[model samples]
Target: MTSWRLSRNSVSELRPVLSYPFEAAPEHGELCEVAPGVYWLRMPLPLALDHINLYLLEDEDGWWIIDSGIALGPTEEIWEQIFANQLGDKPVKAVVATHWHPDHTGMAGWLCDRWQVPFYCTQGEYLTGLVYTRATSEHFGWTNEQHQIRAGRGQVGADAARKSMGGAGHITRSLPTSYRRLEEGTRLTINGQRWRVVVGSGHSPEHACLYGESLNVLISGDQVIPRITSNISVSGIEPEGNPLREWLQSHERFLQVLPDDVLVLPAHNLPFYGLHHRLRYLIEHHEDHLLALEEACSDIAQTAVELLPVLFKRELSDSQIGLALGECIAHLNYLYHRGQLERSVDDEGRYRYLAVDDTLPMRLRKRQHQADTELPVQV
Candidate 1:
């Protein structure tokens, strides 16, 4: 149901060119060495985006895993094969999840229990995962109904959304009871090399990306991918939150601090060299969406549901509607928070957004200008 794939609006000729160093990905059960002592492992997901990239960081004593795939039987079996044949007989030292997504953390508990090692992730990611895994099973349907209804879905549409909520194969595994926190600037020494934790939000709270300075490599977990822009949504729990703003700000910060030439190992796509260019593409992609959405809202008040076609022109599956609606609300909330749009609620409780004026906000204008004119940064 989660549409983790790239949206229809993410593609444009203005997108920066990226260079893939690897011609092909390693097979599901095998591992490929991307850098010294850093191994890339691919796993299969049952979603539209069918694969996730996991990494292994070699330590003097043992190996550290970047992420654990979803807790399905086949995924567990894949781990078993890797343990038996691929690990070179080294014991796993620690299990680390880049964020709280099911695809990233579902098998974390199982791995920690098997290896008798500590589980590590940011506190926000760990706590949020507990909330979703513990609470969503029973309340997901009812909660989704209310959320969609408020976004202008009719009873039939809302019912369809409710039916598509939690069932089988949805984040079935719970996280370990405890975990070591990976915060911003946390440095970890592995195999005599240091990897620092770079945390970002919006995609998930405190999503952790690991940076190996000496290797000029980054294990970027869904924050910066080569092919697809990560799905940034305003959750049903926090309707007014400005996650799009947070998502954009996080990318802007990365462009400033991270080096341009880091070979990024993203969770979804292949490893590539173009950190800064890709970051700008992501920022501008959302900016273009915001401008189009603003213009669409100028003529008449529109509900989040009504604006879906403006962002995604392709047909959406029943499972994808929930994800699409949440993303729509995120863009609306971004403009609403910037005072470029005004929101109103009807007696039936449907929310509508209308633009305040034709003039673009100063901040939005400034960001567009910077993206167009700024030269390549050395940092």
Candidate 2:
């Protein structure tokens, strides 16, 4: 058996009402059939998250790959093994990435190069991936420092974080210079089953989830996980972005559009059922966190760094500072935009957030009315 190791902080003790149809996840370099032609593949990640689940959808002439793992020697070795033993001697038709995150698109270029196939992803994801893939330390150092300083960390903290912030070379390896675009509602028939592209946001720009109505399966890439919530962070690319709001809004959109009976194949954790149950849980989870963060900001003005304790209870390492700060800012920006909090700069050149009004927490009730106007369309 291959070791599936995750840091203690990454594991969640709370299991929601979602149902897991599969008894266990596929071991490394192995595939488990999830649907008629969809198979599950897990790859190791040298991070707190530990692993990411990729997918293979079979077609008449070839197979479609979803989400290549991070660019690591072990990951490549596992792919080589799978290519030698699995795939039934069929060629890869295309490499589809749900988003631009390194763990999802890290090996995409290499895979496409190997199979001589086109890389499929949304325009937003593709462009964003290119920016990150070619980003130098200087590109991030100045902007990231400014971002951190505005988040309430002083120069000292900013310098420390800048030094710890590794370049993109550590995560993403390469990307195809040219590629195919996956637009919203785009349908592709594979093995007589139609899969529609369901675009989502907040976690990443234009994240795509594939929903197959006939198969009753959804390939949700970090959009909806069964146990842990996806990281909705404000990055240096968009410092004042209210991604938490967008994240919640996306969940609302999903609840309105997607069916409850589909089996969700997420990028993390085990594949599960009870889509509606999990979606509602995810919305409530963030709402609860927002309320907690709101309450934390009521008494005294708090910096994003200071408010990190309210969201994450564990001790954070230096390498995790960037993500932690980004998530902290996301929560602050959500409340700030919702009129529940006010932001100001402190004497130390750091941002501080404080509650302003007794307004009710923002609700998604109004979003339902607008859902139909933006229904999925044919590509």
Candidate 3:
């Protein structure tokens, strides 16, 4: 690997007087190989977003990679060290990205170009990722998904919202002009084993996952993680996100295919057992989200502003708060779909929610009804 700046002294080993919040670059020295023919790599990103995991797979052709690091200097430098030390003299035959997120697909284009290989992914993720520069998405709010959020001191007017997306475009590099679309169920070989493709949704469009039964391994992209719950955020582009529903179904799909002990290699966090338990946790988390928002909006007339806090579970700045809007819309939309929440646009053009009669999903409907009963007499 060429010498790059991402690799430097182990600054983490040095003691710190005090740790700053949201340090831009993550510590990159914490890489570990979880299994033979599979290596887990970490690279520094520019926020407290935590370290991103890039996977390397050994195949008969050479080294097959499931995602690339970001396109920043620190990340690039780390790749240089990686290629030199671990992949030295090895060829990268194919590059397959799990989704459109930059942290996972950032270095894909560069690696494909450098190694003269073809990049493959779902067409939607590819096209979206192609135009997905921080510059692009920032042009508008994260998407129409955000515009649907109502607020109490939360809604930034149209002008401020647009300003927030500024330079926020392109979360990841778009697919290069030269690439192949990976079709679901297509068989591929890696590390001398035949693997089948599985597609997951409600996270990114058409995210791809790989399962090798012989090795009892699943290369789960962002679909599942060990620690942090993956955000199934509603983007402006997909407003009618039944993500809560979609994600739960995805969990069932993920659980149905693999055996109990198939090792999981995720895009983030450490490898571990208990795939079913993790899926249950993710399902339960969203279930809580659905219930929490349902009850919060029941007590009073609520807008995106009112429910952002309950949904986000963290503080948001003037800009980042926009996601709260989409979150509100998602829950409201979910309830609306289930016939649990009534909705109508008021004079100012904001949608209001009221609980409705329902028997299905009784847990959510029951709380929503109580909140609805106590709601205001006036809109």
By lDDT, who's the top model here?
1
Tell me the tens digit of each residue's lDDT in model 1 across 184-267.
999999999999999888888799999999999999999999878899997667767788998999998998779999999999
In candidate 1, the residue pairs with backbone N, CA or C atoms under 3 Å apart (3 or more residues apart, or in different chains) clash, namely: none
Counting clashing residue pairs in each candidate, in order, gives: 0, 0, 23
Stretches of candidate 1 above 4 Å error?
1-13, 140-145, 164-169, 360-379
* TM-score of candidate 1 to 2 decimals: 0.90
Looking at model 1, how many pairs of residues clash?
A: 0
Tens-digit lDDT string for candidate 3 (1-379): 1111111111211221221122232246434565667666677667666567677787766888788867665776777777777775778899988897878787787778788898888887887675545344345553442354333332446556555442423444444666787777888877678878888887777888888768777889899876666666665566566765676788888878767577777777666666776776577566666666655555455665656776665788765665566656666677779887777655565667765544334664454454445422210
Candidate 3: give its CA RMSD in angstroms. Answer: 12.1
Root-mean-square deviation per candidate: 5.4, 8.9, 12.1
- When summed lDDT is taken over every stretch of 10 residues in candidate 3, the lowest stretch is 1-10
Give me the displacement of residue 50 in model 2, in angstroms. 1.5
Better of 1 and 3 by lDDT: 1
> What value of lDDT does candidate 3 attain over all alpha carbons?
0.65
